[model samples]
Each structure stands twice: as structure tokens, then as C-alpha cells.
Target: MEIVNFTPVPALIGGALIGLSAAFLLWSQGRIAGISGIVGGLTKPVRGDLAWRAVFLIGLVLGGVLYRVLGFGVGVDHIQPVVSPTLLVLAGLLVGVGATIGAGCTSGHGICGLARRSPRSLVATLSFMGSGLVTVFVVRQLMGVGA
Candidate 1:
């Protein structure tokens, strides 16, 4: 339960930006900013629907790069991996499967769906948070992997 870096101001700003971007996407394009859906759409290209998805994904990557270049958040030197590449890859695959099964990722369910007062989103978000908490407990407390 120890916090390594607790920069509330930067965290707040970053969260606000995410919210704003999600809101803008919903307002402007009548779309939810669900990254998994966006990426999934890219995999099975459709007519007239490619541009915004590509741009959104690109913006995500470029936003991180811009943040790093501007030195606004945690630096590269401060980032230390707590897991092996293989484990990371496996975890990513699990997440992808979960997103597919659940119908949307956190951005879509937690942010956009919750904003719209959707019951399914509430359940999905709760499940996501509960699973995350259990995973952290198992990894840090039981396995002593990250500790």
C-alpha cells in the first residue's frame, strides 16, 4: 500500500486532460473513447471509419511522447519495470481478452459509460477495480514480487 510517487497536481492535470479528450470525442464525433474498441476497429478496417481511429491512436502515442519531451511528468529515468517482458506481454494479452469479453475497456466503461449512468458500465468498472486490487495484493503481499 505504499505510494512511490504521489504528485497530486500532475495526476489531477493528467486526469483532467483525459476527461476533456474523452468528452470532446463524444461531443464532436458521437463516439466513446474506448481505446480497445478503437484498436479493434483498426484491426478490421471499415470504410470511412479509419481516419479518426488512426488519429486517436496516434494522438495517444504522441501525447505520451510530448509529455516526456516537455518534462511535465515522471521522467524515463524514474520508470522501473516491476515485471519481466514475458509477464508483461502475457498480462497485456489477458487484458485484451478481458476487454473483448467485457465489451469495452476502462475508458469506455468507467469514464464515458459511467458519465452516461449506464448500469453495465458500473458493474464492469467495479469488476475491473476489484480484480486490480486482488492482483496487487497477490503480487505484493502474497508473492512478494514487487516488494
Candidate 2:
């Protein structure tokens, strides 16, 4: 399969959409569009609060599904990650653990928190970015673990 050529248009569009969504959520409901917080609220949901959270999570999943179904990105092909299954599972587990320990996922901290001028989220976002950079350096540059 061919690696897709890079372009800025789609990224800019996506970012604008995300910002608009966040702003709309804040304006309409006075709620931050943080995925982790929304999803987490589902676990011990209060009456009348569960519906929106479930809808948000479902919309998140359906976005990707819709994208693929409509022939965007990798089109209709089943696009698998380049990493091994074991590595993928481990990475997912690590992200979940980090989100739990850090009290928010990247979307919560990076997008919503930064927008709200949160110092803790700033720190968490920076640390996560740094960790990601180091991991990429070690995995790709040091270990030569890629296609």
C-alpha cells in the first residue's frame, strides 16, 4: 500500500472543526469537550446526565467509521497500524494508565485545558509530548523499529 502524501488542508479543517465543537459545547451547555471526562462520567452517571456522554462517545467512534466508509484517509481498506499486536496492546494500556494517573487524557489536557489556561493541563500536555518524542526517538532512531 502507498503511504499517503502529506497536506495541511485536512489537518487545518479538522482543527477548526474541533475548536468550533469545543466552543459550541462550552457556549451551549457550559461544558468542556473533553473526551476522557465525558467517557469517564458514564461509569457512575447521574440521572439525566448519561445520554449526552453516551452520544458524545458514540459520535467519536462513528466519526472514524464514517471517514473510512466515505473513502477518506486510507479509503475503504482496513488500515492496520505498522506496529505489532503486542506493542499496540501495550501502548493502549500505557495510554489508559497514563490518563488515569494524570487525571485526564491528551484531548482533555491539550485542547480543553489549554483553552481554559490550565497550568496543570499545560504541564501534563508538555510531559506527554516530551514522552512521545522520546519514545519515537528510541523506537525509530535507536531501535530501527519501523517499515
Candidate 3:
């Protein structure tokens, strides 16, 4: 296995921000700020829920814009995976559907759910992580992909 030159600082900073945002959302809004729920609200929204979801999403975009303007330049040149665009899109769709069916995504289940000390969330997170590890092993080791 090749060593990865990952910089921990950026990851730590990102994790802190994510933790803060989740905590704030739970404290202020009395809601979990799951991205899927926020986006789903855009489609079939309740009366009071729509406005905040819209605001949250808009704030997300505005936050990105502000970061860029303030010279926190975005990382554009991400490493590419060895998969076709079509396959990636399909996989994303499947994951989205699975998350919806499973009641939450990794951010919601792994971060916020575990924060609340929910057993179901812990199981879901472990399953998700295990599946991801197995998938990566199969793809990189067995299939010789994305090397």
C-alpha cells in the first residue's frame, strides 16, 4: 500500500466546523441539520419548515461565496477516482436513495446521531463505514482501480 501524504490540519479544521454547525443547528433550531432533509424540504415542505430550510441552504451558498471572497479559496483540484462519470452518478443516486431509506446520511447518523448517543445511529454508522472499507478494498486491491 502506498502512503498518503494527508495533511491533518485541514481535516481537523473541517471536522471542528462540522461539529460546531451540527451543535448549533441542534441547539438553536431544535433540529438536525441533515443536508438530505434540508434539500428534501425544498421538494415537499411543511409550512414553518420551508423557510428555515431555504435560509439554511442559502446561507450555505452564501458561506461558500464569503469564504471565497475572504480568500479562503476553494479546493478545486480534487483527486479523481477511477470510475466513469456515469457510474459515479449512478452510485451517488443509489447512495442517496439508500440514505433516505435508512433514515439518514453519514453526517446525520454518524455525527449528530452518535452525538445524541443513539444505538441505531451507531449501528448504521458502523455498517456504512464497514461497507465503504470493503468497497475500497475490492476496488483498489482486487479490481486494480483508482491506483
Candidate 4:
């Protein structure tokens, strides 16, 4: 098996930026920077509350656009989706269900919740990471995908 190169600097910078964003949201707006919570709130809007969520989601989309425009992750393998679109959609639905069941998404549990030392977040984050590892193992080793 070919080992993947790990770029610590970029990963560290990205993680730091995410933490900063979460911290800024909490510090400034007294809110958790959880995508599912934000977007779910959008589905059932309340007066005087939908604007920030819309702005946050829009910023997320624009960030991806800016990243693509800057040609980040251009030629490196493993960046592109390996699964079929149907499977991708199914996986997304499952993730949505999982996030709902778990009461938060990865950002909520992994970053903000952990920073606040929440026990629920600890369990949620561990389960999230463990499931991810299992999924990759099944896809790559058991299924011989992208091998």
C-alpha cells in the first residue's frame, strides 16, 4: 500500500483557522458554530435569527469557491470523491441522520464542544472518528476501492 504524504503545516493552519472561527462565533455572537444547527434553523426560520445563519452558510460556499479559484489541492490524489454520486448522496443522508441523532455535527462535537469540555461531545467525537475509520477500512481494504 502506498503511504499518503501528510502536510502538517497546512493541516495545522486549517485547523487553527477553524478553531478561530468557532471561537469568534462564540465570543462575538454567543453562538455555537455548528453547521447542522445553523442550517436546520434555516429550515424553520424565526424572526431576527435567520440572517446570521444565511450569512454563515453563504460564507461556507464562498470559501470553497475562493479555495478553488486559488487552485488549492490541484493535482494531489485522494482529494476527489471516489464514490458514485448515488452512494455519495446516500452517505450524506446517513450523515444527516447521524448528526441529528447525535444532537450535533462534527464541528460542534469535535471543536466547540470539546473546547468547552462537554462529556457528550467527547463521546460524540470519539464515535464520529471511530465510524470514519471503520468506513475507510471497509471501503479501501474490504471493498478494494481505489487500490
Best by TM-score: 1
lDDT of 3: 0.83
Candidates 2 and 4: which is better by lDDT? 4
lDDT score of residue 134 within candidate 2? 100
lDDT of 3 by residue, 64-126 (tens): 787678776656335465698987998889888878777788888999999889999899899
Model 2 lDDT, residue 12, Cα: 93
Off by over 4 Å in 2: 1-5, 44-47, 68-78
- Give, for candidate 3, the lowest lDDT window spanning 10 residues: 73-82
lDDT tens readout by residue for model 1, 1-147: 578768999789888999999999989999999898898888878999999999999999999889778985666667877898998998999999999889889899998899999999999999999999999989888999868
Tell me each candidate's TM-score.
Answer: 0.90, 0.84, 0.85, 0.87
Q: Report the alpha-carbon TM-score of model 2 versus the true structure.
A: 0.84
lDDT value for model 4: 0.89
Q: Itemize residue pairs with steric clashes in candidate 2.
A: none
Q: For model 1, what is the C-alpha lDDT against the true structure?
A: 0.90
Better of 2 and 3 by TM-score: 3
Task: Give the winner by TM-score: 2 or 4.
Answer: 4
State which candidate has the highest lDDT.
Answer: 1
Question: What's the candidate order when arranged by decreasing lDDT?
Answer: 1, 4, 2, 3
Candidate 4: tens digits of C-alpha lDDT, residues 20-94: 999999999999998888887887789899999999999998877887788864744347788889889989999
Location of the lowest summed lDDT over 10 successive residues in candidate 2: 71-80
